[model samples]
Target: MSLIRSLRLDPLPVVTTARVELRPPIASDYEQWATLRGESRDFLTPWEPTWPGDDLTRNAFRHRLRRYAREAREDIGYTLFLFGRADGALLGGVTLSGVRRGVTQSCALGYWMGQRHAGRGLMTEAVRGIAVHVFETMRLHRMEAACLPSNEASKAVLRKAGFSEEGLARQYLRINGQWRDHLLFAMLASDPRPRA
Candidate 1:
């Protein structure tokens, strides 16, 4: 193969819902991303993993982009930032990680919404849009997600996106510096999607 073709990464297309657009983060998004994450720190920290000391630094964002590019090149993960379609405002981000092929054909879904943008149902729309990209475009067989049992908003988003609750996982993940139990949810390619 030519050098360019050999270095090509898997396509990560922009996905659009009614009010949100999902696309991979670019270098220009650094300022907006940093601002949003910084502002939402208090609101998001309770449900997210403890932030690294330099989490919002430009260097850290560069590292994130590098990691994302590497993951895409390896066909192991995809990360997209959600923006308001009409005003082009950064709303949040979604990640489809830990992808497995072969008989599995599955990956994990993770997301976060800016504090200012929460409670608007934008996340549900973004999740649903990404689901279509996952099942139809990426051709993955299944998508999985988990959230702390106490997170009613996250649970509602998953349900609205047509994911069925599977079961609870003990100490499934570390959030806010503590191991927390999480409720697992999954959706298969054959599953019916909610109307948009």
Candidate 2:
């Protein structure tokens, strides 16, 4: 595969809520993305994978964009950045990944909010909007999410967005440099949207 590939669809669909907009990040967004992630570093580190030495660099961001585009084109995943509708500030990101098709049409949800935007209800709104896209627009059967057992806020957000706790996964993922247990949550296409 080449570093650059053309996407069949021109201009990715933009998801909007009352307070925010979700869209794929483009090249020009590098600076704002870097700044937002930098400011929220300490607040976000615990729930995320360990940052690389050059995690904040432009080159790394370029690599991320390429991967996001490639996966989206291959119909396996989607990643969107959340921006404040009022001021266009970079707020955070939401992704539906690990997609499986055929017999099981499903994907996993992962999201994060900037420290300043925490507890504002924006992330919840984004999740609901994206869930609609996943089930209705993308026609996937189910969406799943996993979070650290200690993450009460995340657990609540998932519930508010219509995901029911499924079970626990022991040492599910490596987070902040350690393997951690995570509680699983899922929503199916037949599940009614909580905010609908």
Error at 81, model 2, angstroms? 0.3
Badly placed stretches (over 4 Å) of model 1 are 1-9
Question: Which pairs clash (backbone N, Cα, C closer than 3 Å) in model 1?
Answer: none
Model 2, position 149, has a per-residue lDDT of 92
Worst 10 residues of 2 by lDDT: 1-10
lDDT of 2 by residue, 1-196 (tens): 3333453553565899888899998999999899989999999999999999999999999999999987888777789999999999999999888989899999999999989999988999999889888887788999999999999889989999999999999999999999999999999999989863
TM-score of each: 0.95, 0.94
Which candidate ranks first by TM-score, i.e. highest? 1
- Which lDDT tens digits does candidate 1 get at residues 1-196? 3565467766777999889999999999999999999999999998999999999999999999999987877778999999999999999999999989899999999999999999999999999999999999888999999999999999999999999999999999999999999999999999999998
**Residue 127's lDDT in candidate 2:** 93
Report backbone clashes per prediction.
Answer: 0, 0
Model 1 TM-score (2 dp): 0.95
